[model samples]
Target: MAAPSAGDRGPRVTGAARGGTGRPALARCVAVDPTTFAAAYWGRAPLLSRAAQLGAPDGFTDLFSPADADELLSRRGLRTPFLRVAKEGRVLPETRYAGGGGAGAEITDQVLDERVLGLYADGATLVLQGLHRVWPALIDFARALGATLGQPLQVNAYLTPAGNQGFATHYDTHDVFVLQVDGGKHWRIHEPVLPDPLERQGWGGRAEEVSAVAQGPPALDVLLAPGDALYLPRGWLHSAQAQSESSLHLTVGIRALTRYALVEALLELAADDRRLRATLPFGLDVADADRIGPELTDTVAALRAWLAAATPAAVAARLRERAWAASRPAPIRPLAQAALIAALDRDTRLVVRAGLPWQLVPDGERVALRVFDRTVTFPGACAPALRALLTGAVSRVGDLPGLEDDRDRIVLARRLLREAVAVPADDLSGS
Candidate 1:
């Protein structure tokens, strides 16, 4: 790809790109009506939203920068798989680009900047995988989106050198939103050969077929410039190549849960049932096959009935719990937080920890505040105040809506602070 000109670069937007109070920032990143997106093109078609000409003016620069790649490559000591090199649709082994750790022939998978730069100059696309684990900005973005979508999220970055393509036409197992950060890239998207393919179904098994179909007409073809965003459903065949200069883009992957997954989870839960736990009859020939078939049919019918009686809301709640538990909170300093809590008072300005989801459930005379895998209960009278803390802006213990007595509000605030559910408003902004 060719270098972007001065005109292509614009003023930078700081802070997180967000839509509305309840809306996910991702909704604004794609420039689409969230309701329309969910109802129409969510898992159906490809949609391109040209939100900006360059350097998206919607505070997206806070999520990533070109310098991030340089830091990871030249200083972070990234390992295999985390940093991969691909050229002309083929992946080069780490041994070809990575070197050993300092002072030893240990063959650590650390990236040697000179070697990686050399490979990049030679047209190898630099692939940085699982960036959400290492990049703080991405972790915040992914967690926020995951809470909005009620599923977990992952992020990866692709840095392709000018005029080079990383891989052949293929489909992703998970849905992807491509955020073009720098330079430009031409993309061609084709209809899915296998609609809604499972994670186990990869393009490697049918490369020739994919190449053949990709050679035909494309469903959508366009050049994505900086700040442009493209959403593609899982199983949509696509390929991209840098225009004439290096291209840097981030891919946020959404691994949506399917009804099949719910059924699998239910089956695991059903293992405790005596009927499901029973072993099959002793081995025999065709003589016993007919009897076994009838029993198996009966079991299937019972399982279907059980599944029918299972509530959809309950299943969804279970999945949400799992996703939240799997997500890691942004790093926190225990000692600093402890000190802040010790000094906390009614005047302390606080906010719900960013990226942490809190749900209030009423249980008889008590209200349970569920977050991560833990639930803390307080008197039902405190619901109003807890709700305010969960949903409102930076607030002080004195500002809790339902609590009339300052001492009561302060006690509640101290508990929350000590539990790390709420942090100082100024500290929350750092993440």
Candidate 2:
């Protein structure tokens, strides 16, 4: 790839990206109306939103720089799958480019920069996977977009050397939004050989079909420049080549929940049925299609009956669990939070973690504060103060409502600080 240019990049997305009135993360990616996108393009067709049409002058350089990629490759200790190298559609093995960690570190398979440089010089595409977990700017951007789209999102970056095509024409299992950060890339997109493919269905199974389709004229042929964004649904056949220079782009993959997943949840619920749990006919011919026909018919009838009786309310809880598991909360520094909790007082300032989702549910005599997978219950008397904290902004312990005394407010604040649900405000003005 190319070197990081020396100059001011642009305004980058930060923690503040979560609650903005302007175009949201999704709006920034797609230059079209949100309603139009939902009705016409989402999961249905390919849409290219040129950077010029995106309204904001800022490009994605602020999100990641070539310097950042070099730092990850040369400084951070990255392993095999996290940092993969590809040349002419084939992934180079770790043995060819990775080495063992030295001295104090006991692990092997750390990427060697010298090895990577040699591979890149010979025309290899560098794939930086799961960057949202490591890169700060991307972490915030993914969270903001995921919250808006009601689906989990992961980010990866592709940095290809000049004039090289990373992979041959193929499709992804999940939908993607390709945000071009630096330089240029020529993209050729074709209709899907298989539509709306699930995670288990990969393009490798249909290699011949993909190659034949790639030989045909493209449905859309365009050059993605810096600040350009392209949205491609799952199973859309596509390929890209770096232009005259290297191209650095971020691929935001959407992990959308599907009807099949809901059906899985329903089947899990059906396990509770005593009828479904009953054993099959004693000593039955398990492989005889003729003998199994009646049983299959009966099973389908029973399933339909159970499904008719099921309600959305029953399945929603499981869906929430799955969604929360897919999404990530901001990392909290344990020692710092511990210190803050110990020193906390009624005069201390607090800020709610951005994008933290929580709710108060009645739990008998207590109220349950449910955030992510955990539940923190407090006495019903603490309701008003808890309600005050959900404003998603800075607050002072002394200003919290319902707690009659400063000591009680301090106690509640201390618990929350320990929970990391609330953090100490860095600035008094909440700026």
lDDT of each: 0.76, 0.82
Tens-place lDDT per residue, model 2, 1-431, is 11112121111234224422245788778988778988999899999999899865677877787899999999999887788899999998888888898999888888889999999989999999998889877876787787678788899999999999989999998999999989999999999999999999899999999999999999999999998999999999999999999999999999978898898888988897777787889878979999888888888888888888887766865666777778776666678788888888878888765556666666778877777768799998887787777663228899988878999999999888777677778721122
- What is the lDDT for 274 in model 1? 69
Model 2 clash pairs are none
Candidate 1's C-alpha runs over 4 A off are 1-24, 51-62, 77-81, 99-107, 284-292, 326-335, 360-368, 373-388, 391-394, 398-415, 429-431
lDDT (10s digit) by residue, model 1, range 337-431: 78887787778888777666567777778887777769788898888888777776337788887776988888888888777777777784323
Worst ten in a row by lDDT for model 2 = 1-10
Q: For each predicted model, how many residue pairs clash, with residues at least 3 apart or on different chains? A: 6, 0
Q: In model 2, where do residues sit more than 4 Å from their true spots? A: 1-23, 56-58, 392-394, 427-431
TM-score of 2: 0.90
